[model samples]
Target: MKSVQKIMPDMRHFEPLPDMDDRQFQQWNALLESRTGSTLPLERKTFLVTNLGMRMREIGCRSYDEYFSMLEGMEGLREWNILVDRITVHETRFFRHPMSLDLVKEYVDSKPHDVDTGKISMQVWSVACSTGEEAYSLAMVVDQAFKKRGDESYFGVTATDISPASLNTGRKGIYSERRIKEMDASLRKEYFTPLSQGEYEINEYLRKRICFARMNVLDIDKEPVGKMDIIYCQNLLIYFERSSRHDIVKNMARHLLPGGLLILGSGELLNLDCPELEKINNLRVLAYRRVKEPNKDQN
Candidate 1:
């Protein structure tokens, strides 16, 4: 047999692809919104281009039209899953917003003294939970709150995200030092154990209290977790259109138990008009409470 030489990529001739024009951009925008219910603004077109282009290069795609057509083709589901993962924002840290957790703690503290928490354990849903920080943080706070009260109250968290990649990280329950830096030292010590140098894992007991599932916010009708006592769907509405945001808020309200708490990103759902939800301002934090008789308006 004759020896053959392998071909290598011609690095010297390499160049990045051109940016998407207005028409091409709209095509991508429609695809993203149709799949995720997220609206990408004109100003953020470059962000769209960058993320899509990176995936394009990986798949050897030369133009948006061809990639888009492939996305709509029979094998598109697998490709769409990969592309959507890249597009969805996952920038987060351990206890990214302590102020938000504080509000959650306050709610737990206010639980009725005579209520049988043992029979009816508190349930929290961390929507769009990336890598488990926010979900685990909520668990830590709720657990600590009940422990300090010396009450039999128990709590569980159901964390959901659209990305399987993110959920896998949550299931692993390991985090780097930088991810835990912002967490309070006391809390860091109590709920997490140092696994190795500059890394930690959620305590086994706390890890067991959380269940992870894949969920698309756009498919609100198919929520995996049932009704919850508190729903943390924060920092996500800003990505949706005004009408869509209201719809999302309404869907979240529907998932709450009566008197359940619905927390949103500051100003994310401002002036939302949902008769079923009563808005509350706690120490300058805005939250919504599901009413006993929600006006039954279908969003």
Candidate 2:
């Protein structure tokens, strides 16, 4: 028999795809809002085109056009969720923006015990709690504060986010060393265990205290969540248009207990026509408090 030599196939080279045009960008933004209830700004549009375009190429798409076409044809919601996750910013760290945490501490400190109901507890909702850092940080602060007061069981934290993947990571309570650097040394030692290579895992005690749920703020029904004492919806409203922001604020106010607090992103504010909320001035950070119920006799 004659010996035959093996043949090899030639690999073709690839090139960077073109950027998305304005029309395609608009379509993508509309699609995103329809799926995630968030509107993309011009800067965010540029970011998605630049970053997610690269991601599309990595996933074997030759161009933005092809990738978008594929996206349009997809039937399931998961694909849309994945696209939103790609473009959504998840920049968060332990104890991020201490001013917000300070406000939370103050609110907790001021809460009064129920004379008739025994020890009164408070509920905190960390809206858009990405990667669990903010929620866990909130839990730690509440836990530590109440522990010092001999009232560790008087508070609970409800952490919610739209991304299931991020929630899963948060629920795991494990983090790389860099993520926890800003955390207090004593806190780190108390709440986390060092794994190999500068990684740490959050203690189950803190993790258990938090209830992480996947939620879309726009579609959330107020009745199921009950009333909350403090709602931290920071850095989330900027992604919404004015009308959507107003709607979200109204819905949030309905869920807030009387005399509860509603914290918006530093860049967000209530509309002048919104009579349900009152802004708290002289604060170093952006904060607001819900107005108390009107006297029944006055009504």
Q: Number of the top candidate by TM-score?
A: 1
Q: List the residue pairs that clash in candidate 1.
A: none
Per-residue alpha-carbon lDDT of model 2 for 1-299, expressed as tens digits? 99999876422214556767888888888877876778777766778777676566556666666666666644646555676667777888888778888888888787888777767688888989988998898888877777766753467788888888788889999999888887799999999999999889998888878999988897765438977888988778887777888888878877778788887778676553456678878456777787887662132
Candidate 2 deviant stretches above 4 angstroms = 1-14, 63-66, 69-74, 221-223, 270-272, 294-299
Taken over the whole model, the C-alpha lDDT of each candidate is: 0.83, 0.78
Superposed Cα deviation of residue 278, candidate 1 (Å)? 0.8
Q: Give the TM-score of candidate 2.
A: 0.86
lDDT per residue as tens, model 1, 1-299 = 99898899855335587768889988888888988899788988878888888888887787888888998866898888777878888877766677888888888888775443344368999999977888998898899888877877668899988888889999999999888887789988888889778889888899999999988898876655577889997777889989998888888887888778998878787678998899886655668888876454222
Off by over 4 Å in 1: 1-14, 113-120, 294-299
